[model samples]
Target: MRLNIKITFFFLFITKVCLAQDWMQTPIPGIGNIEFPSDPEIFDQNGVLIYKLENDDAFYLVSIAQTDPSYNAEIEANLEEYYEGQLEGVEEASGGTVTFKQDIGIDGVSAIDARISGVANPELPSLLFKRFVYVNSFNVSAEFRPKKTDELEFTALKDQFFNSLQLDVSALGSSIVVDEVNGEKDAFKKGYEIGYVIGRIAFWVFLVIIAILVFYFIIRLLRPKKKKEPKATASKPVTKQKIECTNCGKSNSTEAKYCSQCGYTLPRD
Candidate 1:
């Protein structure tokens, strides 16, 4: 019927309208070593990454390494995101015969000043590739060495790429800056620091207040309630009944005398 069709269309329209109101665009900013940076100031702009790994093995190795603490689980997580972002994007994805090294910052905030080089060729590669991958072409410098080589050491560095203790940045530690110095606590900046401290204090106070209120309500509920006694009502007079003792085979208290068969006393009497 025309009415049903109109009603259906109306419902569909209402659903779409509600959906539009509830719609939210979640932008998953790719995290980790390999990623798609959308900042106009970086890369080829247009957020397009044209690089591809010529070395398939190196890509896999880096992917594994990223999961280790050093890479912040970005290799696996970021590559997927990087590749995903590359797909159906303003950029074309390619990874072959290309190598470069670059310092990567997370969301342009915290930075890691290091080189990332991916090489695939292995007619005879050095022992360095035992821990890191050999990529012929990467974004960062291939020959960049560390100043503090012996600062930390890892025995199982080769076995696990996503090790948190192997001079590897973990997903948790890499991008998160929990213990920060941002207050007048630093003699360098007083005004901003004081404001920050105030804000932090307010946040903690709010949490404590909420916790206290929750406890109060819980205690109020757990407190025992007084039970009401049922009202007594006058009814009928009760009647008594008698029974026999099976062991002695004697009858007692049919509201009567003891059994003549046995010398048992009457229960009711």
Candidate 2:
């Protein structure tokens, strides 16, 4: 009886291990494979590829779409704006308020991670965790909506779903490049491109002008000032020397003819 019990326990343990490692790999062309906890329903809607999986506790979704060729540079330059738009769209669709948001990167690719709470639903109020990744010309999204936010299993599943996404860098190297000359160009789009370029150039020129003005003012402030010199004054005139009269023994001017007190004539030199 004891031997039979030991064998049954061993078999059960082996089965549990196999089930734990039963993640399914779903391949996405031009991107990479994502490991789903179970087989997900895949479909295409309006040129966007979508994969969905649902269980009693939570729902999982993955979406992939190719971006318009003309807006590649704009999206790359303004990644934050693109992310904000995506978050806003999610909020509007689910009627949820974004509770947490973070900027992240996967395999050197920029991404945004956000959480939404207070989603309005008649059946159950749901919590959503979403990740938006930009891979070259493709926009990849992964989402998890759990029925119960406080459950440990749901949290672990959320982490597993997000982490299982693998991007193949080798496939991304041969990216699709659209030749604009061969395609029809809209006049409005062309004008917008020209205006955007002009705006960028004008912005840089303004910044350079501001920098030069600031440097000039700083130089003026730090430079030493020159000192002023004192003015010259006029000199006083010298007085003539006086002479002594011999007879009166009195002093008189050098040009005097005689002494005034004695009435004697002055001797000529």
Candidate 3:
């Protein structure tokens, strides 16, 4: 009977895995959208919205909260401290201990990534991977809890679910807006305008400098090099001219008045 039960459970597990192959994108009201490997069971616990998906191997969950405006200032003041409190809350609720925690960010918003282990019950999932994102007055949390940490499918699903989240920035309103006016400006507004103009001027100046440098280098490289001229060689030393003697057809030096062999008269140069 035990062996038969094991076989049935194995088949059920495989069936669940196969069914989860088709993922779906789900949007939470007032928060953001994320992908789930299968249709999630959504619940509202108090003011928090929870989206949950479970299989025989693991449990996936995402929770979102639009926090009170009063707490926004405190959260903004010390985000790390707020996250530490959140980590402690998770540990207390799950009866687990955080094995590792890392500071992370999503879309310029501060966040925390953490792993929890040592749950109270061994039958329950003892390993958990979690991420908490704080944006404006919103808090988003995602978690993946699996029976075994080494499972490749669980790891892949965790990564996919975490990466698929996209926050709806439009839902979060801006705190400040400045408009153009011709009237007298307040000190803060005047300073802001001056700084803006200076920043633009600096940016254009930097670009112009870079362009000039590039142009200079291009001209220098393209210019032709001057060709070297060959040096003039020294002229050969002049040799004394020889005169032919008419008497005996003997050669005589230009300086000689007469030929030595025939005593013939020679013309002077």
Candidate 4:
């Protein structure tokens, strides 16, 4: 009886272990959800969830976040950088050798896919596959590895994770990429530059017009004023005395003192 009880207890324990390993689907608020291994380590940093799954041979990390608005115009160029940019520290941390890397698209969304093999620590050489997907305003990345201390095998695991991804289109928002002709110069920037140039030209034109008006007024104010001429007056005529030359006329009797023909004095009135 005790032996049967012990057997039953062992069976129950085995069943519990199996149940613990079963995969489960969970929804991440504001993002989407996926079927991950049971009891995966989930961390929420700044509203973003960083989920991690591990086994005897490999480990996987999946994270989702929104794309920054400042980087929207250069989305295409940013997608090109799979190694030196976003994965800046991976090579240093894992001492891994990148095997293959490529850029792909799905339903208008852009992505980067890469595979690497390296020693994560002193004991084991790990193989890792990483995929970065750009969905509208969000960015989703997954790093999968096979065995922590085993040979690098990524094909099977890569397929599993990629297949299970369920993205919520509404949560991703709208695409932020801006088509540009020059380096990072979009329509807004170009329009602003053109507007600035036009504004400067208009300001100079206004200044020129003001200067011309000022010069015209100044010339008018500096001109000399005309003086008025004085009016002419008529002069009186002078009368000549008849007593002149009375002494020589012979009719010089009337109170004549002297006459003009001879040296004589004239009478006073």
Kindly list the per-residue Cα lDDT of model 2 for residues 1-269, writing each as its tens digit.
Answer: 45445545665665466447645666665677677776677766777778788877688899888887678788989999999999999999989999999998888788989999888875644788999998677899999988665768787888888888888867863343222211212333465467657866766675566556555665666679878888888888998887788898888988899898798987778
| lDDT of every predicted structure (CA atoms) | 0.32, 0.76, 0.73, 0.60
Tens-digit lDDT string for candidate 3 (101-154): 999777667788898887776667878889998888878899988755577877
What RMSD value applies to candidate 1?
23.5
Better of 3 and 4 by TM-score: 3
Q: Can you give the TM-score per candidate against the true fold?
A: 0.20, 0.57, 0.54, 0.47
In model 3, what are the clashing residue pairs, if there are any? none
Local accuracy of candidate 1 as per-residue lDDT tens digits, 56-116: 1222122221123445445534543433332222112121222322233333222222222
Model 4 clash pairs are 57-147, 57-148, 58-147, 58-148, 245-260
The whole-model C-alpha lDDT of candidate 4 against the native structure comes to 0.60
lDDT of 2: 0.76
In lDDT terms, which candidate is top?
2
Measured by TM-score, the strongest candidate is 2
Candidate 1 at 138: error in angstroms? 23
Q: Give the residue spans of candidate 2 off by over 4 A.
A: 1-16, 123-125, 173-269
RMSD from true fold, candidate 3: 19.8
Which residue pairs in model 2 clash with each other? Answer: none
- Candidate 4: regions farther than 4 A off: 1-22, 45-48, 76-78, 82-84, 123-125, 148-154, 173-269
